[model samples]
Target chain A: MITLYDFELSGNCYKPRLLMSILGLTYETVPVDFYPGREHKSEAFLKLNPFGELPVLVDDGLVLRDSQAILIYLASKYDKTGQWYPLSDPAVLAEIAIWHDFANRITATASAARLGLSMFYDVDIEAAQAGAHQLFRLLDEHLWFGEREGRDWLCAPSHPTTADIACFPYVALSEEAGVPRQDYPAIRRWLDRVKRIPGFTVMSGVFPAGPAIEA
Target chain B: MNRPNPYLNDHWHVVAGNEAVASGQPFRTVLFDVPIIIQRLADGLRVTAALAPEKPLPVLERYGFIWTSLGTPMPLFEIPEYDEADRRNMNAGSLGVAVSAPRAIENFLDMGHFPYVHTDILGAEPHTEVKEYDVEVSAERGEVLATRCRFFQPRAATSSAGGQEVEYVYRVPHPYCSVLYKSCPSDENRRDVIAIFCQPVGEERIVAHMLQSLIDDVSTITDMRRFQQTIFGQDKPILENQYPKKLPLDPRAETPIRADKSAIAYRRWLSQMGVNYGVIPLVPRVADV
Candidate 1:
């Protein structure tokens, strides 16, 4: 069984949890009190992730840090369809890597604003919110054109890839940081599409989308 | 410090789609700045004001929407179009807009913005004029109505084959609810009814729920919703960037021309009803110290 050094409220920790759930893999969560307790900064947890992040996954004696890296590792090793990571297609692989980097940028801006507001972290809240809006503008436009072109997921793949999972949590939780998704209707619709993915689960502040109207 | 409730306590708001309140799962939402929780039990879904879970709020399921009234409210207004068996009923899903609920309702009632805000999808730059329309208050029915409006569009809706002349009727059945009846692309005699129900989460925030009841057999529910989402997505940014977050009820608060009849009538109706939940209360200018 895999073990996750997790914080329930942290969006970074939610990344691996979401992927693991989607892949239908069971894992044990070792709760880390990241807020008031500040346990992720504890000396013991640092041994697992020197970066002092909320999510550190240990699977079959191979320990991993970084939510994006864990998503890649999990998808590559377990996804039988090869659609999540798609190592077989070099071009798709390159596109997924680029989005993963973009996901980090989301963490720095959207997630940072959230932390500053909810956790009382020292950050330029205005700058972070502004930065998030700039990124969101690009994402909304890309998704809008993608919809017109009949593409659903972030990358060119017909189905969702790990990049969707990497970027979702922060965007979904951006409201807590005083950055509303109101202006990004495409992004909001994308969030609903992401939630409809099988085996989807929610972290705090991230609610499930209503069922799509059917026949 | 204590604060007065900023929401119109007596109005009914669409909180979610009926399908969203599934069994064994709880859905959370804030209406009129009050946190609410809805749970599906063996009998049916139970909705309560979050702070007083034991005290159940009045709930009604209609038009494929689950509605909750935080305070005493009259029965929901009837939409006669839904009774037609040939019509397709769809819940187009909820949207969050940073502007006030009243502003969203006004946007729904305004056709002047179609050429500019909605662009080629609903209208084109060449046809920016909103011709004169009739507006009146039906005191007996307790609603505001605008009629005899026509506009040219490149793509009227998702089902549009190409550009066509579309007739529109805008109606406000309640303070936070606005409905539109537009000419159907498929049938000349039939019209499609689209309603936008706004939930004022706060003075400057709203969650919009849409329902599309149309006389179209060719399109799937998903297709209908996709078309609405795309149109609303285009309007999101413009709605968020409006200078004053609240709807200014005073006519002098903002200039109004002939095309703004619907919006003008709406503001007058809201002011007469004493609904200030999302209206910007005019602040007196304190002479600069």
Candidate 2:
């Protein structure tokens, strides 16, 4: 059995849950009050995670902290389709690693700004929003050219991988953080593609798009 | 930011969807940066400003929405088709858009961004031409009307299966409200009505309320909602990134082309009304000049 210490609103917590849902892996969540309650910072909770961050996962006694690490582990061990974490492809592996890092930058800036604006937190909102736009420009250009060359995802694979899931939540929730994706048409298209994934689910503020218009 | 602008204050803006103000529950929202709360009393909904809870403000419930104003407003505008038979009228829901009300109305009037912003749904590539359209502000009715607008769309509605040329007629009855009469998928003789009633939460914040009245029998309400939401979701990002975040009433503030006829007319109408709440007025600031 897999147990995830989760906050309902935390995008980091959602990352693992999304992959788990897509993989059809059954898991239970120990709900943590991350907002006004701040249960994650409780002394009892500190034993589970020293950093006081959310999304602490324990799968059959194996503890995992970071959302990216949890994703790699879940996808590696349970993804029967083998497309999410394709260990056989060394190039794909490198590409996924780069995007995982990019996803962290998004969390630091986009999620931080969201915390400051929507959630109560002492975040440097202006700097965080500026940082998010800088990263969005790069991500948009990469996806824009990818479409030109008939590539559809963050990675080169025709099929979506964990890289797509890793970077989706914060970018999708950028609006709540006041960092608009309007200037990035390619990025907007990519978000729709992500929503159309077979097992995609939605959190608050994130709604599903209708089925893609048949080409 | 919660200062007075009589032109807008005198017009109705949607505060909440009628369903949102449930009995025994209090619904809170902001209009023109002033927080207002609505509670279902024994008689009806009692609306009051957050700061002045003692004094009750007036509210008109109609068209699946709750309409309100800070001052005396003209009678609500007419939607003749709303009373017609055989239409599936719906409150498609509201989205909090982070842009001025005028910016949202401009985007709603624009057919030019159909190909780029709402690609493959409202429009597709290579069919980007926004054909010649007629735009005018009615002298007697005091409304902005744009007719004969046409565009090729890949999938115009949830019921649409393939591409088709969609005809459109745009109407702006209120400064923050826009209505679109588009080609209905189920009926050729009739048209689908899509309206956005923007609540000016602040100068740069809007709560866009959508009302869709369609002539479709095949598509489920959920499917229709997702279709409309998908289109607006696509537009939200593009709308939010507009440079000033406020629509400039100055004709020379931003460059325009023939394709921007309806939007140009909207700016002109707003300027004539002297709505200064969520727009950069036509006159330049002396310090900047």
Candidate 3:
């Protein structure tokens, strides 16, 4: 059985879990608590991943970290559905790469802003808010042009690929970081569509029961 | 300078405005067949499309489109009020039909499942409290109309320090489109709103129009624009994959766990909006309320 080292609430850790579930692969979830003494940095965990990020997937003795890399690996290794990862054309790979950059650069930044402001440490609120806005606007422009032209999936013609999986969590979770969903209805609608996918699972996060008051 | 088609295909058509779009005026495309009309409206940019009278439109087909304002691609659709018969036949293959209103509202109420479903990107935990709500709805011509509704949720860390809030808003224009606004506010009161307009094209798909702007003067718009571009680049893949041909919702398929609050609420909201709500089973465990 594959062993997934993860934190229950971490989005980065949840990626592999979501992928495994969607692909119907069985794995063991080893929970790591980040709040107490930095468990990820322990020597034993370091042997698995020097980076010490949660969500280290160990399958058949092959270890991998980084959510996107793990997702790519799992799909390439075990996915019976070729729609998840395609090695057919150069353009497809290029398209996947474009979204991979999106996940790493854009999504990471947004996630960081949320973490800085809400979870990790209280950083410069102004700077973090600015960063979040900047990211939202850029995404808005891209979607505007993309929708006008007809193509639905980011890279492929019809079906979703690994690229979509890479970007889904953070963008949807931006709202949790205090990024308003009302401002980006297109994105919200897109989120709704993603939720409709079969075998789709949500990331583990806290959501306010009532409407949140703006501070 | 030549700009590659954002949709990645050459055969799709693009709509710019009510007037025929010029061959090259920076318009968004949808489903490789229709073009969305983008224009500056009194509220913001209005995106719509004109369809030929003779065109064969589907019943409830939803399409994937992008809103430029946020640098994210979003799904857009046209859903008529549900008929009882239509509600019974809800399935993945028949998404074009309308569904229930109560179910849609229920979907909107659950917000706890963000982390598990999208994972790594959207959720970090399950079950957070909502701090405030702003809602506006009206009845039009004997039909229950949703003029606008905004919901806000605060993060835990900022909860004590007058935490930041995420806001969601929705608007509708009869036979034209629906506009949704999502915004974020920081502890320092810096705010940005991303506006998306969903316009119908044929029966299945709608074109998404977008605009994003920051309320803070601390940063230059150019800087904001660059930042928005990077963020949208990340969201492109998921949004692109979600539309045109979306996977059908199967309520009877699996029971969601306590972590799936958001997904559940979202489904209820869709039902309340008179759209079909899939019949996914609710997990037996109670969410951390």
Give candidates' CA RMSD values in order. Answer: 14.5, 10.0, 21.9
Q: Which stretches of candidate 2 lie over 4 Å from their true place?
A: A1-83, A86-164, A172-176, A179-215, B2-4, B284-289
Between candidates 1 and 3, the one scoring higher on DockQ is 1
lDDT for A131 in candidate 3 is: 71
lDDT of each: 0.83, 0.86, 0.46
Q: Which number leads on TM-score? A: 2
- lDDT (10s digit) by residue, model 3, range B1-289: 1222332221122222222223334343433234434444354444454343233222112222223211123233333322212221111010111112122222223334333333323234443433334333343321223322332233211112232344544443221233333443333333333333332233323333333433443433333332332222233223333332321333444376643433433443333443321222233345533
Model 3 reaches what TM-score against the true structure?
0.42
Candidate 2 lDDT by residue in tens digits, B178-270: 889999877889999999999888999888888989888886565566567657757766777787998899898899999999889989988
- The runs of at least 3 residues in candidate 1 whose Cα sits more than 4 Å from the true structure, single-residue gaps closed, are A1-100, A107-215, B1-7, B282-289
| Per-residue accuracy of model 1 over A72-129 as CA lDDT, tens digit each | 9999999998999999899999999999999999999998987765444678989999
TM-score of chain B of each: 0.93, 0.96, 0.37
State how far residue B146 of model 3 sits from its true place (Å): 39
User: Candidate 1 lDDT, tens digit per residue, B182-218?
Assistant: 9999888988999999877788877788889988888
- Give Cα distance to truth, residue A211, candidate 1, Å: 42
Clashing residue pairs, backbone N/CA/C < 3 A, model 2? A182-B237
Candidate 1 chain A worst ten-residue window by lDDT: A30-39
